[model samples]
Target chain A: MSRPLLVILLSIAGAGSIVLALVVGTYPISVLQVIETIVAPAPGVVHDVVWQLRAPRVLAAFACGGLLALAGALLQVLLRNALADPYVLGVSGGAALGALVAMLLGAGDTGVSFLALAGALGSIVVVFGLTFRGGDWNVYRLLLTGVVLSAGLSACVSLILVLAPQAQVKGMLFWLMGDLAYAGSPVYAWLILAVLTALAVAQGIRLDLLAAGELKALSLGVAVTPLKLAVFFGAALATAAAVTLGGAIGFVGLMAAHAVRLLGVSHHRALLPLAVLLGGSLITLADTAARTAWAPQQLPVGVLIALVGVPAMLWLLGRRN
Target chain B: MPGVLSCRHLRLQVPGRMLCGDVSVTFEPGQMWAILGRNGCGKTTLVHALAGLDRAAGAAVELDGVVLANTPRRRRARDVGVLLQQEETEFWGSVLDYVLLGRFPHADSWTGFSREDETRATQALETVELAPLSARRYVSLSGGERQRARIAQLLAQDPRAFLLDEPLQHLDLQHQARVLARFQQLVRDERRLVAMVLHDALWPGRYCTHALLIYDGGALASGASREVLTRANLERLYAAPLAEVSYDGGSYFVPHV
Candidate 1:
């Protein structure tokens, strides 16, 4: 398929998923009601359900998905590893530990989000400091550092989970598994996604060159050190924003970029937008299914995404080869 | 449009092994230099240092009488083009797109490459005889084809000086001669500076104006091709006896078993 056609289809799917999320909730609102609520706002049960409750959740899911996938794409390039994801740098592990500790401390939802963001930022700074020691961008060292830190953080998270009270343990687990129950607003998520996406697209050509190889990129006139720094920080910030908003969601980051590439779009110029759209749509639909799959007993959206995304990605990759 | 890429009192080493000792050379326009050395003698290392991608304990390289280290990466790239010996690339772009990346130094950073850049890339592919495979994935190409693709990228770069590491690694004899002839034409017609690390002695003697022989033990010899590429010097450089044969008014060295 042509690039524009694929982009159009992904956009349509994204729009459709948002509408599906609004209409398929426990309230049993019709699609038309969801459309009417969006097109012409009025103070009614449909408006209250669609605008007040589902809008923020759906938008947050989309933004979080976009952010994670974008981060994943950038990290894949920076580390030059195909399996590199947003959380490979231990950012999400740090965020998970923070959110769980907040729960253990009897903190509110706001406190959990704040601490998660803080933890993610801390991870970003520390990893960057250690990886860039002696002012060199060593790809293998960065990967090793991130993996070791992630393992350490995950162990701490497990310790906290084991020590927490039974009542708070469930909430902690929900956060760790990624829940959108208290994602009050997606303003920060959208802001980070928009700014990062624009910046990434603007540097798309350079990113493409960087993917070729660092020495090759430098020889071709790229400021490789600065570009690598920018990519690392940009991916970190995107991951931090997503973790703060939607907990430690998985699969979207790893799979979305791969999906876009499997569909024959590899250039960053085309890859970034299509991956963002596909990721947003995938998570929006997955969240919708998570909420309504077993009505009144919501499954963790992260679990649903992994369960669906793994097989889909495997099939896509398997078919390609 | 032409400039000198010269290094002053440069020391190149790899850990405990010294590649070269305080080697100073000036590569002027209209000069095609062939760097000959045995394996693991740091021929590639010297190229990297000259390209300003690496700096050992020594004076910095200078391009057009300006310090290369202080030059901005984009500006330096517009002036010098380097072809690395080995590639650790995960690039999934088409060959045409891969070649077009060479035009990046000239690109308008925000808007990407121009139509003229595309034309240059396509023409480069045509020059390398990879035009038919322009749409193929770069990684999917054969070894020789990928080497040609890299050469195409360097051609598209169109820098004043070309520093190529082992430019004929995977080429067949036909391609080997053709690529050398192309670089020879580039130097003769465009007055570009060409410096390449070559394993074979025949092509350099045929095509190059000057030769820099980097022996293994921190020894260096560089001057006119005829002066530096003697059978005595080459046999010592490789630690193997060689038989010199003159064919078509060109001297060729063959290793003696």
Candidate 2:
């Protein structure tokens, strides 16, 4: 596909998904009704359903999806590994553990978000402390540390599930599987996504040089140490924001970045934006499908994300081969 | 004064061995220096040290009489360029894009390269006879073509000094000669310094004005081609070998097998 065509298609996909999510729900708002609510507001069932409930939820999902995909693309270049994802560094694992604990204590959604945010930040600090030593960023060491930390944290999560009473298990599982049922506000997520994406895109050339190798980048006049520090912390913060908002949504980061690359967008400038668009659109559509798939008995959006992203990626890869 | 790269009382060592010891050398413009040594003699290590990509313990390399370690990386890169023997990282861009990265030190903006940068990169590709493969994916190129592409990238860098490690690794005989002659022309015409690690003793005598012969056990010999690059020094450098073959007022070393 030509670059412009891909851009147009992705933009249409994003806008179309948002419109579809706004129009399709339990209240059965028509497309015309959705347009009317946007153009002229009234205090009624349509306004309550469209503006009060679904709109914020849809926006949150979009912001979270963009954040995760951006983080994934950054981590892949930072580690020079194709398999790197937002959760690969134990940020989501920590958030999951924190969320499960909050649910077990019977705290409300706000408390869970707060604790999850704390846990995610804590994970970032720990990994940053361990991997950065002697003024050097050890890329492989960071990977190993994150993988091990994730394994340990997940073990703790499993223990919590086993020890908790039967009643709380389902809720805990839903949170672990990523429930955006009570995503507090899209405002913070949007802020983070916007700032970080702009920063990453601005450094696109340096990022491209970095993917070649640290020494190679330095030889070409890049300040490797500072750039690595920026990328590491930026990716960790983005992952933290998304995990806190969406309860550890998986595969959006990995799938979106790889999908963009597989579509032949090699440069970071084009790749980052396209990944963000594809990811945001994907999660919005997945959330819509998850809620309406069973009508009043919704599946976790995280599960649907994997379900949708995995097959699409496989199809993309298969077509390439 | 601002164009010389030199080291004073430098030493390099691995865990159990010393690569080089107490070696001091100065490289001036308009001369191509050949770093010739057998495998494991630390030619790569020395090039890396001179480029300031790696440190030589307690010793600092000076470029224009300023410590390289203290200089800002971008300024150092503007002055010096290095090509490693091998790179483990994978690049997914086109050959032209790869070469354009050589102009990075000259770039100031966060946006794309300027038209001048693109023109220089294209000219570099043409210099290496790779203009036809400019748009080809870098990874898809054959080994020799990739080697040529890297050479083009170094040329595009347009640094004051070039430090190349085994630059002729995978090239055919024709490419080897062509690449050597290009570097020679850069030294002669553009007055750019060129230092390359080479395996063939014959090419240095024919093409180089200066040579550094590194022997095992921390021994070092360096001077003009006549003084430091003799048949005896070549024998000592390799610990095996040689017959001196003269052709058209130039000397060449052949390994006696």
Candidate 3:
């Protein structure tokens, strides 16, 4: 199929999945009722559920997924490693630590989100400081430093989990498992997602050169230091925003990029957009299943993603081999 | 548009050893120079230094009397292009897409590649004889084909000066000849400065106008190819005896048994 047609089809599939998510919740709202509620609304239980609750949740899911996938794609190219993702660089761990600490201090949702963003940025600074030397950025050294720091952050998270009061344990677990129930206005998330997607797509050519290698990109006229900084910050900010809204959702950030590559969308110009669509669809679908699968007893979205994404990615890898 | 690339008071050193020290040389347009040295003799390091990809204390590389250190990376790229010995193989994309990356320094917008960029990339592929494989995945190509594809990418760059490290590696005799002939034609027709690290002494003697031989202990000998590429210089550079033979009015140096 042509690239444009494939992109259109993916977009349609993503929109359809979101619509299905809005209509198929436990309230038994039909698609027609959902459409009516969207187009012409009256203040009712269905209206409140569709517009105030489900719509924002679904939108948050889509934005968070898109952010994660775009971050993953950029990091993969920047690090020249197929396995790189937002979490690989310890961004999510740092964000989670910050959010949990805020919750422990009895801060509100907004405070938690701000702290999370700060922590994510902090991790990026620490990683760069440790790895970058004399204008030389070694990928292997960066990878090692990030992995070690992630492990350190993971230990800190475990220490916090063990020390938290019993009353907050369930909430903390839910957050760590990437629950979207506490997400604020989706407008902020959606706007950030749109802006970031634009910036990343604008640098699509630079990303292509980067994937070849840092030296190759530099020789090709890419300002390697500035481009690396841009990608590092771009991926970090996207992950921070996603974690703030959806609490460190996994799988989408790591798997969505590889999944798109498996489908033969290799170039960044196509990869970035397609990964966003597919990633948004994946998380929206996962969040919907998380809410409705057991109905009345909602599971964490991350649980559903891992349960599904691991096997799917494994299958893709097996087929490729 | 003819210009000169000159390095003054250049020095490069790793932790324990000096690669090159206080080396001064000038490369002019309409000349193809070969940097000849034994393995691990800092030929690659010198190329990187001259290309401004590596910065050493007290080293100064200038182009047409303009300091290279002060030139913006993008502007310098338009005038000088470098090809490393190692090429990235993990990138997944069509050869055409890969080659079009060379047009990045000239692109006006980020939306897409322009028509002129595509035309240049296609022409570069034709020059490298890889036009038929333009649609093939870069990772799927053979070693020689990959080398040619990279050469095509550099060709698409169309810089005034080129610093290539081991451009002939992985190439068969036919490709080596064809690519060298193209390089020779480029230098002759357009007066571009082409400096490359080479292992084969015969190629420099037959095709190159100048040679730079890296001697032991961070010294350099550079001049007209015929003057600097003698059997005595080859023996001193490699610390091994060499036999010189005259073929077609050119001298070829071979390691003596």
| lDDT for B177 (candidate 1) | 88
lDDT of 2 at A116: 91
Q: Considering summed lDDT, which 10 consecutive residues are worst modelled in model 2 chain A?
A: A312-321
For model 3, the stretches where C-alpha displacement exceeds 4 angstroms are A40-42, A103-115, A132-136, A165-167, A319-321, B57-59
Query: What is the Å distance of residue B121 in model 2 from its true position?
Result: 1.4
lDDT of 3 by residue, B1-257 (tens): 96689988888677699777787899999999999888888888888877878756323889899888778887888899888899664768889988998888787645678999999999999999999999888889999999999999999998999888999999999999999999999899999999999998678898899999988778889999979988888889888888888888777987788
Cα lDDT for residue B184, model 2?
93
Best by lDDT: 1
| Model 1 stretches astray by more than 4 angstroms | B55-59
CA lDDT of every candidate? 0.89, 0.89, 0.87
lDDT tens digits by residue: candidate 1, A259-317: 98888888898899888988888889889998889988988889999999999988998
DockQ of each: 0.81, 0.74, 0.65
Q: Could you tell me the lDDT of residue A111 within candidate 3? A: 81
lDDT of 2 by residue, B120-236 (tens): 999999998999999887888999999899999989989999999999999999999999999999899888899999999888998999999888888888999989888889998
Q: Which candidate leads the pack in TM-score?
A: 1
- Candidate 3: tens digits of C-alpha lDDT, residues A1-321: 457877998899799888998997878899998889988998999999999879999999999899999999998987888889888888888888898999899888888888877888889889889988987688788888889999999899889999999998788899899988878787887887899888888888888888888888878777888888888888888888898888978888888889877777787878898999988998898999999999899899989989988998888878842
Give the CAPRI rating of model 2: medium
Clash pairs (backbone) in predicted model 1:
none
DockQ of 1: 0.81
Clash list (residue pairs), candidate 3: none
